[model samples]
Target: MTVSTATGPLRPRVRFTGLARLSPRAGVVASASLIFILVMSLVLPAVTGYGPDQFVDLPYQAPSLAHPFGTDGFGRDVMVRTFAASRVDYLIPLLIVAISVIIGCVVGVAVTLIGGFAEWIMMRVTDAIIAFPFLILILALVVVFGQTVNVPFLPNGTIPIIVAVVLTGWAYYARLARSQTLSLREMDYITAARIMGYSTARIVFRHITPKVLGASVSYAIGDLIVVMGLIASLSLFGAGIAPPTAEWGQMMFEGRSVLDQYWWVTVFPLLFIIVSAVSLAAIAERLVARLEGRTQ
Candidate 1:
């Protein structure tokens, strides 16, 4: 006679209730803000009917019926430029986040799965990159690369900024992914898969990647907010997108000298930047809560 044992349904070792819950009101507000920004970015350009660089009136003109945001130092329409710059402001951060996340995830997962020498090498390199001050690294890269590289579809001067931001940004995602993967690799399911003779590549791609991507995606949303500020700061300091491009940072930089007299020049762009960053950050927080299974 032989004895048999029964197995029960698997349960998680740790419940995420504390980490996952987010306020419903906050979620609603964040969603609404993001939607408003997205709509404004798409709609304002067409409705305004003023070219960003087009001179609508004399310089230093304050907000009025014709030029709602007033004219800048160069007589360009601040309202039009502000709206036009929305496209770049939104686009650059998004592209940077996407590129960085993808590269980081791939590298992180690969190093974790391969382990040993590869893991050591990638982590060291990532650490070294991270050790540098973020702003200085970006500025250095921008200076070395020069700010005029043009890609087929992107704006003429945006390539350098994109490159620098992506380079500096990916390390965070990589570290996040690696840490998540490390914990996930020891899970019962992963061990079961390994015991079942599944190939390493199949296990890594099919099982491991999904579990690790959740946190990375959430972090990327928050990272977008930081990247937006960085881009604006770069432009404000004379190393961002060039003139006539209508980027918010460049606009603020150009208007700084005349800020005392023509407040609209810098204020409007600064307002938009703040709104966009805060809205995106709120959304990211909600997403993190949701991803971690928090509910109120």
Candidate 2:
């Protein structure tokens, strides 16, 4: 007796184009490094015994195996303080960046949906905000709100600073989104959709939003570094992160007094700030190229 076994059908094969097959090598490396640094920032605090303000060494000690990054003017372990400080410093820019994107996207979509004199007025308002020096804008807000205020969620005043940054930062994204929308609004496809009786809301959210997001996302990534720098500058100037926080900017400020002795105190924080900023910008550069559909 001859018996034949039944077999299941095979799955479809997947293929990739040249561009899709190749990955952004530089961006991947930069992103990986940044992620590693962020993770270390969290985990390092656990193994260390000293806190940011808990001094444990002779003041102004240079780099040693016991201290690693050495002791600051207050005799605090630099490594421990840096790790502890990461929680605040890192989160501030991350929060600001996220808030900025949300505000920008909303304002951009709104300006596009409602055009004419209203759009002009809103655009001008955005321009006015953007025209102010970034640090000056932040300082102005910090002074008015007393640097820290109670928020519905977060107990710390950092939320207030994040809100202020977001408020002023969205203008550029709005302008960019509006320009792209203006060009897209007059497209033949949009005209067809309009003629087909599609609702304005549907067109804006369903069709326009996705297309404009590419530009806005690219813009937001680039803007984050600028925001972080402004935050650091404010912290250095005593307009940000109140006492007891081991922020990089505050560290820099503290280092200024002991520059002749404890260079590591200042150097390490500056190095951290620079590395974080550069890694982000490097990734952003690759992303911008990808978003614009450009090749090597």
Candidate 3:
């Protein structure tokens, strides 16, 4: 199905009710915010009146027309790095959340299809994983892998964060899918399809999974922002993307000592992170509202 929105031209309706229509506003704002950041980040390498790492002004320059966000402790342009680091900072969380969601869908399907004692066992194991404080579990994983382990799939250090996120975050998706599947399996359409001799796999995969996907996807919108914030928090604590990288959390960490002196260094990056999070959260809220038929 397709859906239309209040902004721009009409688009296809996605069948979410009520408040889901508001998702367009959220989506547009989020997209605009990210795009603005991305454009700045991507162009930083090319269009530098001042380099992110190069000292251009006196230390702790206040915001001005020339240096809109002011200068940092090292006199590096705060605005430049904030824009430049946008891609690197956002990229990790985006990747982590995508990987986690994919893993969630796979695990969710498996848990539901297996049912019986197997389901119980799998869920308990998942519950254990879920019960861990997210920060503590992440810290433990970092210790096991060491602070800077290279990923087998990616040459960079990003793989570890992705792995950590997927491993820790799937339980919720699994439970959601399993619960939905349990109820769906007993529905008349599924029963009729089964009676007509559809293979168990076909009924489960084709009939049940598709219906649940809409709800799962809507849920995932919320989860994405949560994942972003979690990753940023980890970064602030020193387990996320490392230094010399333009990640918002790391930027905040780098600026702490000089914050009283170079407040803009910390403030701009933190502001970007907050804006991005709020935008995504808005989108998720709209999606939930629409799905629940409360969009009006």
Best by lDDT: 1
- Any runs in candidate 2 off by more than 4 Å, and if so which? 1-24, 148-157
Compute each candidate's TM-score over C-alphas: 0.85, 0.83, 0.80
Model 1 local distance difference test score? 0.74
The candidate with the higher lDDT, 1 or 2, is: 1
TM-score of 1: 0.85
lDDT of 3 by residue, 179-274 (tens): 667777778987899789887668756887677667677666656666666666776666876555556777788788888777887889889877
| Clash list (residue pairs), candidate 2 | none
**Residue pairs in clash, model 3:** 2-12, 2-13, 2-14, 3-12, 3-13, 3-14, 18-295, 19-294, 19-295, 20-290
**Model 2: C-alpha RMSD to truth?**
13.3
TM-score of 2: 0.83
Query: Which one is best on TM-score?
Result: 1
Compared with the true structure, what per-residue lDDT tens digits does model 1 show for residues 166-216? 786777667767877887888899899989999878876788776667666
